[model samples]
Target chain A: MILIEGKDITLGYEGQGIISGLSFSVEDGDYLCIVGENGSGKSTFVKTVLGLVEPLKGTISYRGGLKKNEIGYLPQQSGIQRDFPSSVLEVVLSGCLNRRKRLFGYTADEKKKALLELERLGMNRERNASFQELSGGQQQRVLLARALMATEKLIFLDEPVTGLDPKTSSELYEIVDELNRGGITIMMVTHDIHPALNDARTILHLSQGRYFFGSKEEYFRSDLGRMFMKEAGHDHH
Target chain B: MIITEILSYPFLVRALLVGILVSVSASLLGVSLVLRRFSMIGDGLSHVGFGALGVAAFLSLPPMAVTVPVVIAAAVVLLHLSSRRKGGGDSAIALISSSALAIGVIAVSAAGVNTDLNAFLFGSILSVSRSDAVVSLLISAVTLFSYSVFYHQIYATTFDPAFATATGIKTERYTALLSLLTALVIVVGMRILGSLLISSLIIFPSAVAMKLGKSYLSVSLIAAAESLIAFVLGFVSSYVFSLPTGASIVLVHLIIFALSVCLRHSIIVFRSHREMI
Candidate 1:
């Protein structure tokens, strides 16, 4: 089923449209990676999908319209976000903030769920540690764990492995693959083309308000893919 | 020695109570401001509070009555302008903060109300009235209650605004509400801490607490405790030594911040040495 459908959307901030006349759809259990150069509206598209920025001229329909407590998300990490004074546990528990009882605090079951999510991500030992003290890879995993606390399905990750070492990135991708196997649809925005080409079933190449969305094999065979490969100095295989 | 004597006085007790109330609320709001990188907005709003005080004095109205609404109005305008700007949130805050401070100073000067600039510049904790204490208490209670109730949403919004919106949290409403609450705290705190020193009361304690505390809740609580201690000590020091209450309070808070920084560095060094061994 189509979980998210954006039709001919145009989005931007304060009347300046960044991307226009774009359309896309995502189904349940699909792992789609959006790739483009910097300033190519990759992040903007992610924001639009997340409803952070309203589309100026089109409709974005959610099949099972997202619930207030559903839809886990991992935003792009930046230096500023790293210094936020929160523990790993507290950050993860925030996923369940919407679910907490109004007058009462976080219930035992909610705390258990947060802990369980952290454990699943192999961050149980670091739950008590400050978020800033963690390494970049560890921070990303903790954020992922936090997102997981909300729901197991329809996770939107913005550049999940942007600055990590190869080993850590591979491990993180393996975790993404694991989540996908568990029936979680993942929509990730990324710049690196190689690893994603290898892992993602679908690749959506966006640029200047235009996009080429297709299966990975079809993308590699398309004219835009050929142009991208030539520009990046990769031989067409 | 002086602490006991200061505690014995009813007015001093009232000052301390007012300080505690404002400190807690400001500390809570400080977390959001620091995270958002709009810490200077506190300073700007406090200056607006000073201008409002001037207006109040001129009109023979209670300073808080005028200050609260005016500061809140200024905050709303600032929030709106920042949202509409393309220079990003912190830059927008900086732009509005400086302009507001300049206008506020001008307004105060133009009013020519014979109010001591030092009282507004530095805080005069000893002068807190019964009504000021009551207002401070009410603001603190409301701030804490609302914060606790909306803790999750606020946390999510602060940490990742985009993700928070995706999760169906109304980021705009909460952001505006936070700005409004911050304005209220600034106005209420202005009576004891004064306009010039109030922002430091909001910021320094939180910075120190963030360095020491393990969690957000712990950090906020520790900040409140530290601010309370600083307020009492500052009040006492002022009473005994005749020092400026605002400067003394700020100094105590800064001392705590310096101590926390030193402690953090020492721990890092010790950990590194242990790792090497």
Candidate 2:
């Protein structure tokens, strides 16, 4: 089953085109990595797919009975946002806000789910700890738990490892790989192409004057892929 | 005896009731405003309220009714302008605030009621009539109701609006409602707390509570309690010592803020000592 299909989507802000005539599709349980240099509209494309930004001129259809909330999202965190005054449980429980109705608190089941997500992420001890006080890897794990509280079918990650050290970054990628293997569809935007491409079945690369979207093997053998690999000194194997 | 005698007066009772209601409403709205970095917008709205009051007074109209809608309108405009243009909020607030202050002063002078205007600018709690109390009661009720209904949404919006939006939450609507409630609270509070000092009721309690508490729910509850306590102390002290009500209330908040800072530091010290032991 095709989970998502973007047909010739054009995205930009305020009448300025960032990426135009772009198309891609994600199959059920597929792992897709979106890679691009600065100002290549990778984040913009993520926003468009998540319904945060409207495509200038195209349609994005979702299959497999997937709703927006059933798709989890972990956006890149700025230092200011990371310092928001909230507890780990509070942040995670907030992911259930959209599911809430009327003036009631989070239901018992919702609380249990949030707690279960925290326990699953190995963050039960930090449930009451301030979010800002946690380490970078711990903070990302907490955010991932929050996203899990939102949905279990699919997750979107934008630069999930931009600031982490080498070890933590690898750990996060491993966790993400595990989730993908567990039948969760993933669409990730990242600059860490080497490891990300290792797990990605599809690679979508947006460049200044061109775009590349195909299977991982095709991306490695394509002229644009070879040029990118040669310029970055990456092992194409 | 003096305390009981003071309590016996219906006017004093009315004043106390209105003070408590205003404090709670202002403090509840304050937490969201302060967290969003829109704290000074309360001060801006209060100045606009003063201007509206001057216009209403000159026209022999009901000040609360006139100021309520006018300040709410300003709140809408400020929120709209701020969201549309980045880095435009502070300047817009400063421009509107100073201009309203100027308009108020001129209107008072032109109306030849300089002495009476002082009561509105600095507050005269003793003069809170029965009708005034009723209006404040209605405002407080609406504020509490709105906050209760939208508590979780407001929490999510305040923490990370981008994530909230990405999750299909209508963040703009909640933010607009918050801004409107803040305007209503400011307008109602200006009648009893005065335009010059009403924002203290909004800022102080929330700031102190944030220092003391770690979670949003706990901080909000503590802030409400602090507002009520400060109002009672300030009101009783002012009545007993013949001091200005607005300044007295603000002074109490200032003291509470200072003490909260000290308490926060002491807790940190104690925790570190415990760790060492």
Candidate 3:
């Protein structure tokens, strides 16, 4: 049932260690939310696990029939995407690329599946619309549909709601909640931990020198949890 | 009449052939380059090509033999630099381009091949040799074939490389492939279209086409068609007016780009008007 296991991973950029000796694992069908401060190596840990960056010192093994390509990934927007001229349909269909074996074009079945994903995400009306012109929440939905095209087994989201109104983010959260309930294992890196507490069963709190990987109940009882929750309270004012 | 004119002049015929091929390939690659905010890469690569031309002239080697490999290496080096900074390459481009230009100016001056130097700077569209045309054709064919075969991979890589890499696409390789082909096109385009006009062929058509088209495919298709038109018109005008070939083509592109700006604005306004109703 273990999907990803990182043992004593030293996470950082270059050779400079930011967060060291961080060991964690995600079970199949578990909602794991990684939360930390801005410089807490949260994104770096996600990158390390995804093999985008190598751990300065540990091995991350993928198990439970979960290949790297099979894990749907929703990365943060790099802003350059705003300049891209892509239709929503085309954007979502690109999710099927990892599943694609041939080099030519998307299959008719793939197109149909992309549409189905759009329909399921309540974005069918915007299929022909320009991706850049879409609202932030709508774009995330389109991106999520693309991610789903990769696999239904597991999904990795890095800072999925960095820039969004609360109501829109919550609506987006509800969709993620639904996916987690449907037995898709979700590993999301988040700055907005308050909303994640709603659905994330396990908390992976990456920090300066250590990381916390435990259930929500245990996290709420910990020192780091209380501090973050207090910080979350201060942000509302 | 234009056909007759083209037939009468061997240079015009050769220019037409090489110009069309280069324009088509340049514009096709330009869509992705512009979208990725790599518009300056063409300019950078062309300068590198110019520098390679100087080195070739200095060594008395066939220009393609030296220029092709050197420019390709520069293209890969540029790719590496750009990817390293992640959305950088503007400064890198400016630095590399200026350095290459200076080196080219010095090397070409030292080589003392005055006539060849002029041809390289302003383009020798009228002087495209048989071998040059053949090389252009082969490079264009390779560029087109790679675009066709790796269409999906290129699309994925351009749109979102992080997602593409996660989905197991070798984004680095494909992007490098794009840059390598672009190097080839720029090198060939430099020889025929002239270094001055080559950047315009890569930048202008795509800018205009992007305004009219909503999807990458539509934009790319529009860019290629628009480039072909610009090259032909520019070619004919250059002949009739006895103006420079590269200058005339660039002017034609400028005119169409201006019209596209106005037309695109009107289309947006008109579409919104219809929506309002």
Measured by lDDT, the strongest candidate is 2
Candidate 3: RMSD to truth: 2.3
**Top TM-score model:** 2
Q: Which stretches of candidate 3 lie over 4 Å from their true place?
A: A234-237, B8-11, B86-88
Question: After aligning candidate 3 to the native by TM-score, how far in Å is the CA of A160 from where it should be?
Answer: 1.0
User: TM-score-based ranking, best first?
Assistant: 2, 3, 1
lDDT for every model?
0.80, 0.86, 0.86
lDDT of 2 at A89: 94
Order of all candidates by DockQ, from best down to worst?
3, 2, 1
Q: Each model's TM-score? A: 0.90, 0.96, 0.95
Per-residue lDDT tens digits of candidate 3, residues A95-148?
Answer: 988778677888899999999889988999999998988999999999999999
Query: What is candidate 1's lDDT per residue for B48-165, written digit by digit as tens?
Result: 7877776666566867677788899988876666556474756665666666566656656776857666787676777788877887888899998998888777877888876677
Q: Local error of candidate 3 at B242, Å?
A: 2.5
Model 2, span B1-277: residue lDDT tens: 7678778999998899889988998898899889888888899999999998888877778777788889999999888776664758989999999999888887777777443888878988888888888988998999999898888899899888877888888999999999999998888788787899999999999999989888888889999999999999998888889999889999999999999999999999999999999
Q: DockQ for all models, in order?
A: 0.54, 0.65, 0.66
- Checking candidate 2 for backbone clashes, the offending pairs are none
lDDT of 2 by residue, A1-237 (tens): 998899998878877888788899999988999988989888788888888878998899888888765678888876226546688999999887777864668888989999999997889999999887899999999989988888887889989998899999989888888888988888898888665457999899998857999999999898877877777778556
Shift in Å, residue A225, candidate 3: 1.5
Candidate 1: segments with Cα more than 4 A from true spot:
A8-23, A64-69, A102-104, B1-8, B59-61, B80-114
In model 3, what is the error at residue A116, expressed in angstroms?
0.8
